[model samples]
Target: MIDMLVNLYELPDSSELYQRLEEQGIILRRANAYERHIVADWVGAHFSPKWVSEVKVAFSRQPITCFIATREKEVLGFACIETTAKGFYGPTGVGEDARGTGIGKALLFRSMEALKDNGYVYGVIGGVGPREFYQKTIGAIEIPNSDPGIYRDILPD
Candidate 1:
């Protein structure tokens, strides 16, 4: 549950991974504004309510900050950047049945590239779960004393 930092500029190119996903019929792209409700409902049922709320905010941004991997119109996975906080990469998840196809990596890299294009030198992955996955994928480094960094005051409804 530690926050991790990513050096956006240092990320390796993701085009190859993207192409692989494309070949497998998984399309990676920004989440459309009109698709927010469906995406949010999916997240709420599969992930968490907090993430669904944040994904809604991501859709509201002028330039949408959320990305998704879909196949034949079904949402396979999603990754959102700059949702909870500026320059923060998170709220990402892959469907249990749709994992191991490089979708998660594609989503992560795509979102990080977007942040880089937005001039972010570094991106924070707040309250991270898969530490090794982020580290192996994007060389993310742990931020000391960051457990519950921004979620310390989250109250139950």
Candidate 2:
């Protein structure tokens, strides 16, 4: 998987995405310190152990680098920034039941927006999975020869 780059200075507005998710009973907000363990466990169970580890670091950071999609107090999905790698956006997912509601798109744009607000002129979607999604959503471009760019030492499972 190659890394992809996003132009933080040219990101689309985020408030509109927030409003759209809110209308669907989805509350999009930063994960609070008190919710760290719960969120990390959820991510681990639903995603990967590596992602869980990165998410823990995100929670420890001041301002909380993780964002979550919740409905009625239950975690529906999550996205994290500046975790696993600096100036990077990733490790995000929606529950199987939560798919097809635009939740993923909202998470992607909103998290990249947070990176922009934090003074990043450009953000790396490190080791991208959905190439067309990134391309259509934010015009993310391939970082040539970035395969295993930062995960050159990833240990075998």
Candidate 3:
């Protein structure tokens, strides 16, 4: 898993994607402090304990760097920015059942936009899983020699 870089200033407009999600009754918004436990638990169940730890960190920020996709009170997906490090976007996942609903992309855009709002010129996508997806969606470029970057000395679960 290599890290990728994205130019935040060049992010594509996400309004159309957001509008489509809205029509499907999906709501995208920043996760509130009060929802930390719920979101953390969801990430643990749907992704990994490592990601749950990162989600907790996201909740600790003043503005809560986490964004969630929900529908009628059910969480469909989530994205966390600046959790592992400043200007980092990651730890995002969509439920298996919600995979094709555009929730993941919406959550991604929300996270990237937030990074931009925080004065970031470029953002890092750490330990990317879907390399092609990032490349096509946000024009993310591979960072040479970045495999295992910050994850080099990670402790085992």
Candidate 4:
């Protein structure tokens, strides 16, 4: 006889899960205008200040949502959502201290679920990390980038 043990985790609803995030020193609230500016500055140090500014403006103009992970109310991680005529997805980041904890996956799943719920028929994500995760979890595929600098699709067949 062989014995196997599988541990199952239950994901809470948005409100309850958010409470848990609070308890864990994390917060999944929408990023405000100024905070977006701050994020732009911080991330710009490595990426691009122009790109950061673009994202901040984009968030304001569209349904760009963010779920931020925090500790002591300080940002630890964040997932960005951009919803357009095309689809919805993330350019998510997990802090050095928050990686390897399934936070990114959760953020990805949440984004996809929201997209699906909003009646999106397909999703094409830019970049790589979430693309790979989508491939494994939702049967996403890497398609040729229609435009330069973009590459991957997580849409249903």
The candidate scoring highest on TM-score is 3
Worst 10 residues of 2 by lDDT: 11-20
lDDT tens digits by residue: candidate 4, 1-157: 1111111122224454445555665555556766776665555554434445445654674454655565665665565555222453545666666776556655655665555555655555555544445555555666553333433353332
Per-residue lDDT of model 2, residues 1-157, tens digit only:
9999999889877677778888999998899999999999999889988899889999989999999999999999999999888899988999999999889999998898889889999999988998999999998999999998997888765
Clashes of each: 0, 0, 0, 1
Best model per lDDT: 3
Weakest ten-residue segment in model 4 by summed lDDT: 1-10
lDDT of 1: 0.91
Q: What local lDDT score does residue 150 receive in model 1, on the 0 to 100 scale?
A: 87
Ranking, TM-score, top scorer first: 3, 1, 2, 4
- TM-score of candidate 3 to 2 decimals: 0.98
Compute the lDDT for candidate 4. 0.52
Model 4 error, position 130 (Å) = 6.2
CA lDDT of 8 in candidate 2? 87
lDDT of 3 by residue, 1-157 (tens): 8999999999999999999999999999998999999999999999999999999999999989999999999999999998888899989999999999999988888888888999989999999999999999999999999998888888899
CA-lDDT, candidates in order: 0.91, 0.91, 0.93, 0.52
TM-scores vs. true structure, each candidate? 0.97, 0.96, 0.98, 0.62
Model 1, which residues run further than 4 Å from truth? none
Which residue pairs show collisions in model 4? Answer: 25-70
Residue 117 error, candidate 2, Å:
0.9
